[model samples]
Target: MSRTVPYQPVLLRLLHSAIALLVFGSLITGFMVYDRYDKRFGTLNLPIIRDTQGIHGTIALAFLCLLPLFAIYCFHIGDRRLIQKESFKQLQEVGKPIWWISLQRFANSLLLVSATFAVITGRMMQEEWLPTGEFNHVWYIGHLIGWLLMFVSVAIHLLMSAKVGGLPLLLSIYNWKIRPEDMPKFWLRGFKLKPSTTFLFFFEAVVIGGIAIAFILPLIFTSPQ
Candidate 1:
């Protein structure tokens, strides 16, 4: 008899992968922009690169599009996994197995907050400001702070995930040997807009609307310069 590894739901894996890629891309582009332009905080001596500010802006735009959808899925289907109401109470088990689960939840919650800050602050940044050496903007300061917070949150997330389930939980996000009856197609039914899903539908609509407004408001209000 072979041991079967526990598998994550395909929908969860898909969402996680998409979010991970976007987050990683944004982080890379953000660093490149920082190194290429801003060094007021710290300096990394590297070869000069041109046009990364534009690349960073492009990735940030994609992040704004995907993040709201990811947040919807997270709050709707994955909130319990990331953070339960009882998580704080698990602090009593600080030296025991339960503590690690709570830690992971807390880390995930922190990561979400950090990512939200990154997205919002990234949007607030005017594209023409950074490469032009205009780091005095409040939004740029907030963006830098968001970047640091995200870096710390991601480190905590990785360490907690490694401690909790070792490599199994980590690999579960990419596992493909799901049971025959557990096909991705079977998962589609859960997405149907029934009474149970009505609230999620409403939540997703609100998120999408908010993102659209955030993107459109500046264009509408900012007069031609």
Candidate 2:
């Protein structure tokens, strides 16, 4: 007997892939920044990129721009993939399929939370701080912790997803098949903002506004070198 492949929405694939790539970029450049400036833990002999901090900040800005849409979709349309109210209760059945499912959901939710944490902390930092040997800033420390949490969350997410859905589910998000109704043009027609999602939209707007301010503030209040 042949197994069937699972189908994923094209929108979800696009958002997930873009965010995943940005997250990986941020992680790499973040490490380079750390290796260059704050190697209190240990240092890598990685090739020095003079503007690694700028590169990381640019990637983080892109992430901030895209994350809200992804968050809205996840909370509204893809809620099933995240932790539910009963998720903790389901964890009691260890070694069972439900337990794996719940664990996957928990990891998925953690991924979102940690990503948001990293982005917020990253935005709070000054690009000049790391270069100027100011590594002890609270925001920088929070950003480092956020990076570690995101790394662990992503690992658990992949492992739990593999355990729950095996290869098919792991590959499903990358699948490009799209149903007619799921097309982008049809999205607006089907889109409806419920009372519950209203708050999500408001939150999304606030995050986007904050990102805009994060960009504009540097120009308005330039710190003297």
Candidate 3:
């Protein structure tokens, strides 16, 4: 019999949702804020974001959309797609249905399409791919909306990732060459550990405290005195 692929874990699901919320929020808001190059936000003259604006937008949209469905597909198999046969060979035990594979590919396609639209539109708005637009009334507001959504999404994403195993998971991205002999009998069963009051601090530090600093710093620094 042919072996099948694996599904992502629960914690990862939370992270994906948070990232999606942010990306969609950012994209829609960005549509409002910087729709024109010579737009102004309050008294500050903000440059119309065009060329590279869509790069982050593209990534945000892709991650926002793809990560969840991928996570869902992984959920059925019981591990992250990051550790799949195509990516990480450590997890060859889990199995998946053919239909799930098709869905995953479709999700990936949506992500690519969203990115292309965001990038293309972003360029057009800035006149990189098209001529600059005359001063429109709506663009000034759109840019602010985009920035707000993006800001919220990233904060939530980071919080969810850190709350569970996002930080450690990030570290493990570079992990390599673990000996099969040295490997535990069931790593997926998870490592046993002591729980503590400190767990709440990850909440304080990431969701509340971390967001405050990451977001507020930019606003403070960027605003004209």
Q: Which candidate number maximizes TM-score?
A: 2
For model 3, what is the alpha-carbon lDDT of residue 146?
A: 37
| TM-score, structure 1 vs. true | 0.82
lDDT of 1 by residue, 78-173 (tens): 655566657778977877888888898889877777776677667767777866778888778988998999889988998998787787778888
In candidate 3 the C-alpha lDDT for residue 31 amounts to 44
When 2 and 3 are scored with TM-score, the better candidate is: 2
lDDT of 2 by residue, 1-225 (tens): 122577777777889999999989988898888988889989887899877877888898898888878877776677677777677799999888888888898898778778877776677787788778888888789889988998898889888877877888889888877689677875544333541445445544554555465556556655522
Total residue pair clashes for candidate 3: 15
Clashes of each: 0, 0, 15
lDDT of 3 by residue, 1-225 (tens): 222222333444445555555566555445434443434444244455554345545554454345434333333333322112242232232354433443333333334233333332232233232134444523323334435544554454444334334456434423443545334453334422321224322322332332234324434444211
Candidate 3 stretches with Cα past 4 Å from truth are 1-36, 42-144, 173-225
lDDT of 3 at 128: 33
RMSD of 2: 3.9
User: Model 1, residue 196: displacement in angstroms?
Assistant: 11
Local distance difference test values of all predictions, in order: 0.72, 0.77, 0.39
How do the candidates rank by lDDT, highest first? 2, 1, 3
Q: What is the lDDT of residue 17 in candidate 2?
A: 97
- Which candidate, 1 or 3, has the higher lDDT? 1
Candidate 2's TM-score reads 0.83
Better of 1 and 2 by lDDT: 2
